[model samples]
Target chain A: MAREKFQTLTEQMFYILLALQEERCGADVMALVAQITQNRVAIGPGTLYNLLEDFLAAGMIVQTKTEGRRRSYTLTQQGRDRLLMEKQRLERMLSDYRHMTAGTEKNQRDTAG
Target chain B: MKRKFEFNLYAPFQYQDLQDHLEKMAGRGWELEKAGYRLFTYRAAPPATVRYAMAFRPEVGWMDQLPTQGQEIYADYCRDAGWELAATWSRFPQVQFYRSRKQYPVPLETDLTSRWRVTAQWMETRFVDPLRGDVAIGCFFAIFLAIVLTIFLAQEEFAPPLFAMCAAADVLMILLVLNQLVVLVDAQRWLQQAKRAAEEGSPGPGGRMSLPWKLTTGLLIAAGAATLAVYVTNATADFGFLAPVRIAGAVLVFYITLFAAFRFRDLLRKRGGSPHWKWIVFTLVATLLALLSVELWDWFTDF
Candidate 1:
């Protein structure tokens, strides 16, 4: 079955929403994402612009202010809920990994002893 | 400034090729100044390395000369990122060319999936839809021609020369239809492959002037030439030595009228006064000029 659009966010989409958690302009959001990720994930200007447009259309983000071409955006409650849901999904996956790996390590130790 | 003009034949989807070609020209001390329908103008400049990016704005009409407010804002965003709007060409999916001013500027697009999505939308709007219309129109004409040929064949006095001319024109139309079909299929295939790569979190496919494309274009040109030859030969029987002259005059009238309309539009744009109604004005002017040219040609030929 096909999933709904934005139902499962891509890594870039996730980070863009996280960046908009606080009101930030487009370029600032881009710089903040790179800084937070320690220069690991770099968002291109075109990509950021497109994602912001989509977020605004999807009602996940709201435009807080506009100065000339510079516009600032912040995540709405819907956006925060979406981001939290994705975080929980990732946490569950991590917990499952830990549970499986811990049992495997314990069994190996038992066999060795 | 010294300038030169050349016809660009790359398809709209072949943005990579256009970008590389412009960069190569810039390295040779020529920089792009403007782009119009099938033509690029370059001015002499010092040799430099420049990165080019193509951004598509599908909302822009094919005849739109003045940029919209949204387009200006988009350019503003790109400008802040070290890219400057170099030229704009109003193809079906209107495109703007941006050149990087700084050394090793950051890429305009980074997300593979987002890039693919934008490109796919442009392709669907400009390439697939238009080609489908062309193919359908071609099929309708082919069927009409077939019916005409059948009726001619049933005549009591079958004329070999007329039949031969019809056959030549038929071959030309068939080649045109076949070329359109090939392009449609190729575009769909490219989109499918790009989609798969994007799904895998990789960059979409890059476009090139493939061999098949070249061969198809060559074949269409040859077919057109052959059809024209048959036409000239048939007309010579009725019009004496003036057949080829008449044909050339008609072609001249068509090209001159088209060029005049576009040049006028460009002049308005340069003066920064092109309004939305310019399209209608251009069309009316072109039609009048074409009619005048045709009438003058007939009078000159008769004289």
Candidate 2:
């Protein structure tokens, strides 16, 4: 099967989608992404706001609630599916790399002996 | 002692320049107090280090209720991210200012894509939409110019100097509009490149209007104003005080019609949720009313 566009997510997109798995406000999403990524991926306010707008527009996320000025959003079914697809794609690449490296290590050990 | 205020003008597209200027002002103990179209007002304050970041949001408007839902949410997000709302300019692009005192400035938009998207959206709504509107305005101007030319040509004793001056001014006005259209096209091209750069994860080149374009626009406006002044002076000289009075009335009517149309459009946007139709209707009605008022005044005064 041909992979769909955006089946592979950027590091920022992955963390953002991962954070949105549960309902959260934009500010909360920033915090969660920073925490989950251990400060390695920092999504600024502007990026979070625009990405959320894009996600909502693309039907990847839905606004769940609006409490005063803060709007809460969660991943839509499509978003979850995309996230899972990316996870599987990443897993396959890791598995291939592991297999290749394992064979090379074993061959090296045989040659050394 | 009262605090002193200073006015500074910056080009709208020079967002980086605006930020740097504001920072420089802050360091000079002149903190930004307000922002208007092409103008910034600063008040004297204790010297402090403040970093300014600008974000463009087109959904916000001057007439709309302050702290709108989207605006509030965005402000809160920025506040949480260490930025404090400093000022807002309710113009096209609808710039919002954020200031931070941190040692390292934290940008509101970290990714190039988001930054480009905001700017591109601003350009589309403000420039592109207006460019579409300009077509109708251009047609109307063409008809008006044709009528003026016909009236002058039909004169039994056409004075070449007067006709030539009037024709020159009309041409300049048309050229002004065309120059604006060119600027809009250039702006659209810049935005497209910016979007492409964003997609490639690089900061796009900032948009800037050409110096020649700016100078031409300035020249055209000055010429138009000078021509208008000359016409008014000649009319007053020939027709006594009545001419000035009539001219003032006409100018008043023009402004009043403009105010009413904008108010009507804003009112429709607030309630019925469709302002585009409001704009179209108001424009047509305003033009009719303006023409009718001028004709009726002329007839009543036996001019």
Candidate 3:
């Protein structure tokens, strides 16, 4: 939802990039999405794999090395910085929401009194 | 082996319409390979069901072998089927479903991607021969027109030497037209080879206007000009030192203009300029300018 800039990168780009940041391989990335979204969201090899291709193109994550038909992607400085920035913005939003909701709760208690 | 025929249909025809037509003739058995971009390469058709194909050309390329010649059969058929015949290259009027032993169907690929464009690079070439010859003819025509117009405006002033100049221009025109036709025939043959070459993935027209062709045409013009010069010199007043040199310089310039045009043709081709049309226009403008320059020189020197 916070991705206001990456219009062409699409919905799957963020999820795939986030998965890569966790030191996950392709299969692991697919499994992680299933576990995190409780299998409600599914990404196909053809489509999801293409997003991973975008990361490869964007130079965010590169195939650090290959091991037995398995290629691993590692974050470049750009990717890590981008992910950390997203996390910080999300955390700030969460804190703002928490304080606002607590004030709303206190106001409700006073009205009941 | 009764040489098997294959149909390579490349077009961007209406899909639903094509699908319905293909479905109607589904029972007609032929090993089919339905590649994307509305391409369906067909093998020999069975005797039972008639072979049918319908597809549209992608923006990049097109092929239709089955053009019904002036009989209006194919046009009528396409009209009925809601198919509009795509524009074919005017130079090759024989566009439509051409019969080929399935092995020999015409290939359709992007012209820009072809090897003719990719591989044809000129390095340190001083003159464009085959190409310049064409341009020279174009310049000759323009100069002829200028000469004719200058004479006409001067109002029937056919001086003793004017007749020779006019005759020379006439001879040059005849030679140019004849040579253009001869080269045009070769161009047609080369175009046929190009169609085949592109099919083979060469991605080029696969030929060049040769040295002999270029040399002969240039010589033909030079010979005609030299003969004219001889006659003009004999008829005109006895010349000073500059007259012979001027005549020599004129011949040299004419030949070299053509050479430069041909040598640079490949470079010009890379830049997407038409050698045929560009040379023609160049010839026209250069000849006009040359004639004008001569007139200017005459005026200045007289003053």
Candidate 4:
């Protein structure tokens, strides 16, 4: 599961999506993501708002409500599809690669010899 | 200490929107140092800033001109509760003088028809982009997105290609415009600066923008005409030829919009048509007739 997740995730992109998947608001998403990241990434309001603003403009996310002078966001059908596609690609690669390498170094040497 | 700007109102304003004007004041190197009720101080920046200040605000009038008694009262009321009035004079009402006389700012170009002749001229001339760097950057980004869209019609990778590109472009443009707008809020700052500059007088302020700007405008107009002539003669439409067309268009549009808006709004407030309009119209008609005759001759002679 970890390998599959790691294979598909873009560090910033994944965290943003993960944050939004739960909170359902823009400010909340930013806040939750900041906490989870331990403040390593301090995105300014413009940058964060810009990204979410872009997402909403593109219809990748829908704004649910206003939270204390901030808006909330959740993934739309398109965004969900995109996230799932990335996950499936990673999952497929993991299962297939493991099967092919199942014999390991010992099996390869004996079989070749 | 560096030279600073100061605003002096010979007459008072009623709904004086200083921030909006000042934000429009700075260009290139000049920036706001301090702003108050009716005085704005710009810290003399590098030479470029001064030049930019000269170029940008040159003489952008407030609401096109000074306010009348009725409008003045209305604007004063519009002022924040704590704001104070600076100086007022009724004799030279609507007459604002730059503290320092750097040659008068070049009047902006005033043509906006998207004609091929104009585009050719724009390409021929060197145009200093009126927009600031950040604004230019945002514009470039929009162009970049367009380029990307041209290459990638649509695939989920960039998904809804046109829509996504357009969305990003629009949002970025808004952000860019807003960023500039916030700075524009310095009207009070600029007015203060301009007023102070007026009071202190221009540093080496003997220079004037009018002469140079006028010549440049004339040159641009001539270049546009020449370009149009050349294109008509050559009968080809290419990048090399069309570059000047854009500048010419920009200059023409910028000046026309600035002056028209200024004059029209001012007329409405002053309740008197600007005397300058008569001269301008006369000059414009004469020039047009000359051009038309020349064109008619060329058609007959094919030169």
- Quick one: best TM-score, which candidate? 1
User: Tens-digit lDDT track for model 4 on B1-303?
Assistant: 565666633112211233224334444334455433334556655433121111111122332344443334322221211122332222223222222113332111111111112222221121112224544676577567656654554443443433444444444444444444433232223344333333333321122222333444445455445545554333323344454554455445544544454344334434445647644654565566556555544443332
What is the lDDT, from 0 to 100, of the residue B149 in candidate 1? 65
- Of candidates 3 and 1, the better by DockQ: 1
Candidate 3 to truth, TM: 0.28
> Ten residues in a row with the worst lDDT in model 1 chain B?
B267-276
Q: Model 2 misses residue A5 by how many Å?
A: 6.2
Cα lDDT tens digits, model 3, B96-181, are 22111233221221122232211221100111234456656785775677567566646766765655566566556556655655
Q: Name the runs in model 1 displaced over 4 angstroms.
A: A102-113, B61-65, B101-104, B142-170, B192-202, B226-250, B263-303
lDDT of 4 by residue, A6-103 (tens): 23434445556666765465445545766888976443322343345445766767878754444567888877776787778878999899887887
Model 1 lDDT tens row, B1-303: 899898887877777888899999989988889887778899999999988888866555545546765577677778767889888874442677889857788788878777777677667776678778888888788767856766665673457767777776767666776677777777888877666655655777777766777788789889889878887787788678887787788778767777777777665554444456666776788788878877866764452
Question: Whole-model Cα lDDT per candidate?
Answer: 0.77, 0.71, 0.46, 0.41
Runs in model 3 deviating more than 4 A are: A1-11, A67-70, A105-113, B1-33, B36-303
**lDDT by residue (tens digit), candidate 3, A2-106:** 223332232355566677875766667766876787875555432343445556767788887666545678788888777777677778889999888998888
Query: What is the DockQ score of candidate 2, to 2 decimals?
Result: 0.41
- The CA lDDT at A5 in model 1 is 65
